[model samples]
Target: MSDKSKTQDEDLPYYDHPTGGWGSVKSLAKIIARSRPDPGIMQTLWRQNKPGGHMCTSCAWAKPDKPHTFEFCENGAKATAWDLTSHRCTPDFFAEHSVEALKSWSAHDLEMAGRLTHPMRYDADSDHYIETTWEEAFEGIAAELKQLDPKSVVFYTSGRAALETSYLWALFARLYGHNNLPDSSNMCHETTSVGLKKVIGSPVGTCKLEDFNECDMIMFFGQNTGSNSPRFLHTLQAAARRGCHIVTFNPVRERGLIGFANPQSPMQMLTSSRTKISEHYLQVKPGGDIAVLAGLCKRVLELEEEKNGGVLDKAFIEEHTTGFEAFAQSMQQTSWADIEQASGLKRTDLEIIAGMYANAKKTIGIYGMGLTQHVHGFVNLAMYVNLLLMKGHIGRFGAGISPVRGHSNVQGQRTVGISEKPELVPLDKLAEMFDFEPPRDEGRTTVEVVRGVLDGSVKAFLSLGGNFARAIPDQGQADPAWKDLTLNVQIATKLNRSHLLVGRKTWLLPCLVRSEEDMQATGPQAVSMEDSLSNIYGSVGKRKPAGEHVKSEMAIVAGLAKATLKPNPKVKWDDWLGDYSLVRDLIEETYPDDFKDFNARMFEPGGFYRGNPARERQWKTESGKAEFTAPKVLTALGELPGEGQYTMITLRSNDQFNTTVYGYTDRLRGLEGSRYIVLINPKEMADAGLSEGQMVTLESAVDDGVERRVADLKVTAYDLPDGCVATYYPEANPLVPLEYHDQESKTPAYKGVPVRIVA
Candidate 1:
């Protein structure tokens, strides 16, 4: 091999700088050109971050405390511009391209094709989507539902769903006599929801935006804050300035965690001054989070023994915790050798970090998919909670747990009754409020929905804004199962791959983007949203509609409810559609304690924060206390794939959000030109006798009778952890086995999957 090529193989390109620099500005400009050409677009775009205006159509990271003129990050701008793009995908566009022809288009190509302007249905003979009237579309769906058992229909919602729409979406399904309400939550934060409820008494975070100003230390476990939530860099930068010790534990040295240059500040932008983040970083192995935390706990316990419980909060633990004795006993049994090997860290490294944790009285723990998308995701989360619990750090100002959610409304969707298994017990109140009998049985989850489709129990699939087929695990299984469905319908603003993954029949109903104006029977209407911190607020779109045919998400849901539940007159669907305040009134009546005068509170400046009970040290758990869970270590990682195998982590490009691809380049990661590439450790490449530009086929170790292989991926040597390789997901999603998921939460294990590379 040539010397230059060898060096290139040893490293993927590096920026040697912090994230959120000039590169973000360039990205924002390019996305604007694709979305629209109107000069007034800029004026409308600026309103996205204004208080009393629409929330950013991207990540739900900000606290919504004080309103800023320029509140949006670069990614947020990209999302809004992409949504408000002037390009139109009218009936003519669909008629020109066949389903087979459209399949060849890349993700970017599909998005650039423009926004869908009307409702459409797949014609069996033509193999093309044909335009239909809204009445005809709703009637067709009602006819399909009339033939099947109510249990046979699966209703799914994406995180982009608004709070107002979500409440209506759930009521419609229950009024239809079933609760088959599966949502995106089941695949992502179900572990955080289930695990945290056991420990902290609340599924949401224990702290609010104001807490960032108080914490002495911030521990980022597995999440990449820079790329995922660029706006959060401001918070980290400010905290760093205040002498907060920022520690990061991840397999990759994410640039965002390293440092950040705030684009908003004129001085920082002109001077090119960057703020350093992550005072301490631990390169923990994939699936090694629990081990690393356990090692820290062991050292803390050892100190407590030496100082006679001086290291732990005896007063807090005695009054507010349960099962500490069992949890502590388990920590003592974990050997240092096992911790070192599993975590890929030295005992001294663990001790040093533990000492820092012990010294900090007020700390915040934040994590993302790295800890959630695993077989032991629930316990993976519980371990961090365990450490914080021992310190009595939770349920206090500046100290709590934060699971940074992916979607803007993923948490809000669940909050407003879009859950498969409804969070509130005794559905009688909800039933009484809506004047209908609610289903008692728990509904199917996102994972269970797929199983239901495969087994023929689910004959129909209806979604509100998500690329369900591409986002879900096991395309090898899910794609075919979808084809077997009696009907598939999607309510969306843009065309996605899920709309193309057809069942016996498919339909696409165009809807309004949050950036576009929504005018109902009333003059103008606004939708409310809840941010990642559970801050509720009203957001009204200032721009004109992308297309006149496109309706608001709430309007669509109300129309569907009116047509389907014609049998029930108790629901004043027409009135709810005319005045959204009526819908909010019902929410207050149903969840009186949580949503007292919900309609009136929405008009407040910067909206409102629905406070967490756990923040006040209230434990709603079965024990009426913050319960401690014993960590369960993985006994055996599946066998290695012969001689050339490695663990695989499915990743998102810096240019992408979830399954939405804004561009082909992962600018933050220094990759360009292509998406079908894999990053491997230099030592792993040497041992496997592989070099750069070499082609390899990746296959999952655990197959479900169907052959799962992603072929001809270009390999490059990266500085990833030993024996671990990484690739962008949706491309690598084919390699994720269908049944390989967490036992408790059923979230697919996207990280640390055993795989073999075919040379």
Candidate 2:
């Protein structure tokens, strides 16, 4: 840890103003100045999130049917500037910095160096990357891939991939005879998909952009809107002004939930007036969401009895749901003492929130990674869904559950069948279309892939666009395992730490980012992205390609498929590359009900919503009704923190998105210059014999620990629940063991890891 001055201590001045306003404007200006992006950056910014322009590459919040002239937010601009940066990591730069030397660079510095300009191949002897032609690169990759068993290969997709690219990737995987298609969703929202699909018959959220307008009450669980989804702040601010009840449950009192000042509001910015969000804020303990939700359901049941059958929609419940009697009995049996202890909240506080929920005719529950990155993440989601079901809150105009996804097109990737589970995709339909028998066995997920790599079971790994090694849990164990792979392929727009984790034969393939125009034989092309809501939009880049050598992601996958797969009469990889609409046609054919008129509907203004059957009261579950789950355990950790230990909740800073560190400063939390400091409750710090600015190490308290620890972390005091600590992610990722994850979904317990701070 650095000195007090360098550490950006807790004593630093707090950001008292609202989330947006001048703070956002200045931050965007600084990023643009620092990146010195291409001349077309201004035009690109103007077109972003508009009807016919490129999608914002940050969060997947839905764009309104009538979007603003400028729909991009501060972080969205940062993502765009990141992609459009003038700095180029050309062949000469790679020649100067050896792979070993680049490995030492900070995550932010590695990306800030610039966009990759050409295809490169790793020179194992020299430990440097040398420029290579795309032809040679694909040929080498194809030759090695042909030798490997399909089950040994993992096709990893990042949220950066568009619907077109993701569909092609899945097609290539199945056509080549494997189902090992793990994606970024495995790390974040896999729990949502697993939990919701079992209960609601749909993996996606039910709410649309219009729902926000009509929703009477909105409850946010562990979602930070300001940093993660800034554009959505406009919607929140409007809801607040309309007098909608906004409740929040989180470990930290995030600035986004407290209040927001829309940067786009001229009068609000001029007067410095802010829309106060969160009518009520509850600081729940880490891994306590299930308990809190159960408590609310219990209270709602109590209110229902008090009101004599007026509180719950009994008719809807009886007709549209199953297992209510058992679920209600489980809630009734739940003791308040247990709920209070697990949630770190009072009975009165929960009752008050429950009262508000009962009064609201329609409600929407929004959440993010905080709720999904836990051991009981599946149950956490199920419990939330149960609460909505109790009141018939779903399948209506303004009522449903929304899991705010991170990445732009993560949901889109999965929608296009980028899943590891063979059962999730329409394998039979795909086989009929492509004339190849697809693999029926379940394949490796993100964590399974890591284990496979380490055990020498996985020989080839192809990443469509993510920092896989860094994003996954237990980097200490997973990072070096990449070298054991026979081949590693990264298709990206820029350099990151994951690119440096070279295998026996590695290839860095540069591709066109979302901001850059993608042209093919069919003329200028547009790719589609599905938002957190099920709405799909066609996005066409306004700017030219970063480099002439760079190709579209779809094109890259097509080339790889042509080179790797034996010639098949039915699958024309090149023809699909020439016209992405052809890919959409096949996708529509694969999932006819969801993607009817896919090509035409995708280009519509604000795209089109692929309506979820669950939202229309059509449950696709086994019983043909919304199924209720009665979890044996009511908490994510299954227990509260023991003495001498605190639950650590890993999070992202305002400056960073996911594992991509744009800068070290977390201005939203009133900290800058460093992200290595952990925020602990002041009393907890005192109890642990630690003071502000003190250097400490956090050791995992798990019994199966193989010395999992993060050393030299500076401790800072903050307002958090007792026995609960907070730290930035990727840095804190090591403390979470790979085996410690949701039992059902396999999503790593990143939000609730038991750790003790050592001075």
lDDT of 1 by residue, 242-350 (tens): 9999999898878888878887778877877788888887888888888888998889999889877678998889999999999999999989999988888889989
Q: Per-residue alpha-carbon lDDT of model 2 for 577-599, expressed as tens digits? A: 89889989988998888799998
For every model shown, what is its TM-score relative to the native structure?
Answer: 0.97, 0.98
Steric clash pairs (candidate 1): 35-85
lDDT for each candidate structure: 0.82, 0.88
- Please give the lDDT score at residue 717 for candidate 1: 74
Question: How many angstroms is residue 107 displaced in model 1 relative to the true structure, after the best TM-score fit?
Answer: 1.5
**477: Cα error in model 1, Å:** 1.8
Error of 2 at 277 (Å): 0.9
Which ranges of candidate 2 are over 4 A from the true structure?
Answer: 1-13
lDDT of 2 at 182: 88
Overall local distance difference test of candidate 2? 0.88
Report the lDDT of model 2 for residue 4: 18
**Cα misplacement distance, residue 214 of candidate 1 (Å):** 0.8
Give candidate 1 misplaced runs (Cα > 4 Å).
Answer: 1-11, 423-426, 634-643
